[model samples]
Target: MNKKTIGRVVKYLKPYIPLIIISLMAAAATTLLSLYVPILAGKAIDLIIAPGIVDLDGISKILIRMIMVILLAALFQWIMNVINNHITYRVVKDIRKKAFDHIQSLPLSYLDTKQYGDFVSRIIADIDQFSDGLLMGFSQFFTGLVMIIGTLCFMFTLNITITLVVVLLTPLSLFVAAFIAKKTYNLFVKQSEKRALLTGMVEEMVGNEKVVQAFSYEDDAIERFDKINDELADVSLKATFFSSLINPSTRFINNLVYAAVGIVGAVFVLKGRITVGQLTCFLSYANQYTKPFNEISGVVTELQNALACAGRVFELIDEEPETPDKENAVVLKDVKGSVMLKDVNFSYVPDKKLIQNLNLLVKPGMRVAIVGPTGCGKSTVINLLMRFYDVNSGSIQVEGNDVRDITRKSLRDNYGMVLQETWLKAASIKENIAYGREATDEEIIAAAKATHAHSFIKRLPNGYDTVLGEDGGSLSQGQKQLLCITRVMLSVPPMLILDEATSSIDTRTELRVQRAFAKLMAGRTSFIVAHRLSTIMEADMILVMKDGNIIEQGNHESLMKLGGFYSDLFNSQYKNV
Candidate 1:
């Protein structure tokens, strides 16, 4: 790409400048030492080939010194390589951690449109491309360049004409590298995208394997997986083939240049200006320079792949999270849990309003039950109350303060929320129940006992310490909901919102949960959202909602006397249960 895009990759390495500088110096020293090896070989050959009366003592000492220098250079090279790996891995680790934290902070809408599998692949496989750049591309490419330049300087001292002929591969190698890099770049990009799609598919299938079995579509699912596998193969094949071109093409070009160097050397020897030893050393320098010629194209290919990954990772890290509190945001003080909505208006999307000009008030310690048909804005009300999404055109106040003025942490901390879906992380039952609240072992047991979950938990092999499977899949739905109830009771916020938390439970468990609810809502302002009217017969203020408007509201007895929407809803309850 352009200079700017390449600059982005350097951003991650800026923090490790000292290590990079040290490594560069070490690499240069190693290249210089390697270049001298051929010269030493040429000199030793001349001493024997010319049949001169050589000084044995001097020659032996020179050989020993040369061998020691070579060993020293190799030791330094190893040290530099170790440092390079350590720094690069640390940088990549930071990139991964920051990206993960940013993704978690993103709004629900951001997650709704993205696939979990695709996100996972980018976080893992895509970042690996950068590892190539760090390990091989930068160090090898720069060190090779230094060796080539240093060899040219030394060879020109012996014979300029011969060195020029051998150095011809330099520009040719560049031409091939540029061409291969361009083509390989596109292939790697395609491979990355296809892999993400494949990852997304794998995640979806694995998460919903139950549904596939229930519908008897196991064969169809395999067929679909095969299609993704083929796409991944096609893209990966193209990238591998294009990247493979670098090695052979570069080697062939280098072999031809070596032959030219040999021919040039023969001509120089006939002129008798340089000794056999000098020509051999010159040839060795050219050979050392040309070896890296084959390596350049491979480095370019690696660089292209790394940049592709850089773009993906940077895109994720740059995503802005949902709106946080403003500067000097007011904190709601000593909230007595009096909630009010004045002319409230909201929509998940801008075009269709789910709650239109709605108004309601929940006094401190009042039990309000919100009832509506599915998607009639019942859950949206809870979403607004929790400030997951802000109201578009109205004010929702807690106590005497507007929700917008308070920090989200403080606002959420004031309310205990239990959603219909019980998402229990794979952890010990005690840890799951005490989540978001710092509680002692005694408090944890009390919360579980309060929800009637402790009785069953004690019967497990490990009791409270038993590890739950993924998403608590090992537990029955009723048990999962009981765990959720216990989770909220432990937090014990001043206000509680239960949006069908008992919906998936058995009738027997539901009755127990109702008792837990009674304890939880004792002195707290609570919102009980229920589809079944029989479940909420004891609600102090039963508000009936239809078409985004509250048509009737009163105590169960008072609403039944009115013979309105609540009465019709109560009458239909027998048909369902």
Candidate 2:
């Protein structure tokens, strides 16, 4: 077991200390009543010492007392179980909530490098596994400890010499349990890791199944899945095999203790040192004492697995969150749309430089279009503008105020964005369009009509109330993009970012949407990223980027006359058209 991880888990129980105390009291009551039953049975046996001399009335009184004690023990046992269930589930709920909240605060840079399904596995599956083990530990561990101690006290009162014999053999059972538990912990850790890997793979393949089938990669996907599945199976089997050894191994040692006590007590009875009734009571105590050893060994096995799962959960909670905003950061308000980048440098990795010494300036209400080949840092500039990433060494200013000085929320609220990839939740169309802002039915319908999406939306069975599945299920790519455009149109912020926003729509719809976009961008400062040269013909200024540097900048007419890189790029697309 990991002492550090176990200690952390115990801290979650502090809020429920009173409940824990009550449960312990119940466990004690149950153990005391159970111990007394054996003594009553022994006394009843003494009353029937000989056939002719049997005291029927005395035996009957002992039986009645035993029945009452048994009923009380059952009641307390039930109370302990109910309380344990409550405590175990509450602790699991708290840990899960903390993990999820921490994931939200993490930086995008961290999220970009990890698999979504692995996080899902940790929060859902791994935490559930930990809950199961924790529940078992609570239900059995404390009761078993009290029973072991209580049985030993009663046994010593009847026969001290036999009780010593049982105590002497305890170390062997402890040693066996400890060794197996130590071996099983690491195996369980490996099993959890493999399970997460499998989950990630499954999620990826299912989400992109069309791409796999289109490329005839089904066999390769299956091979990769089988490899991970085999690993999980192997580790799980080993973990189970080792943990399973604890109960029987401890029981074997316990049986030896029971047999030794029986033999020793019988010898004492023959020598007149103890009566047969006392011998019977001592033998019962011997059996009771050893039973907890078996039960405790089982608890040790489960706790090892629980601690392993808990270690994974704690790792997520302990991750460093994104750097917080300044304590007294100013909120941006009523902004002109001017933006400036001065001597900015940034890279996703430290060793490789992507953008360096870059500079640009855009005035309010200017339509500046960025054009380049695929890896020319077109979208990266948008990322920097939005503060999704910070510049390594220089400054970005909005309306002459340093962007770092402004709160992120207010800064983001000033701009509207629509990407090539459209994302919609599993919700009604009206709800999807009205996301991030409160809008009435008239506003939502107007925005949809403006984007030329109202006709198709009205054709659906439920019209505006149709509930789509995850990511706008069964909706054509063109339809999905239109909804995203409607979302931005509804807000109409002071600044706009449109990156390949009309790529998925047909040429005719693209023409109509571009006109809608023109009206929307009439007075707002807009940054357009495009691969098709014709879409950006009328930009106020065209920036031709190559290798993260601006190779050319001018109006389209001037760039075409200069016959530079931009001219050749435009002519190539023109010929293709």
Clashes of each: 0, 0
Q: What overall lDDT goes with each candidate model?
A: 0.83, 0.91
- The prediction achieving the highest lDDT against the true structure is 2
Q: What is the TM-score of each candidate against the true structure?
A: 0.94, 0.96
Q: Candidate 2: where are CA atoms >4 Å away?
A: none
Quickly count the clashes in candidate 2: 0
Query: Pairs clashing in candidate 1?
Result: none
Cα displacement (Å) at residue 98, model 2 = 0.9
C-alpha RMSD of each candidate structure in angstroms:
2.2, 1.8
Candidate 2 lDDT trough over 10 residues, lowest sum = 298-307
Model 2 agreement with the true structure over 127-222: per-residue lDDT tens digits: 998998888887888888889888888888887888899899988999999989999999988988899999999999999999999999999999
Which prediction has the highest TM-score against the true structure? 2
Q: Residue 15, candidate 1: how far off, in angstroms?
A: 1.1
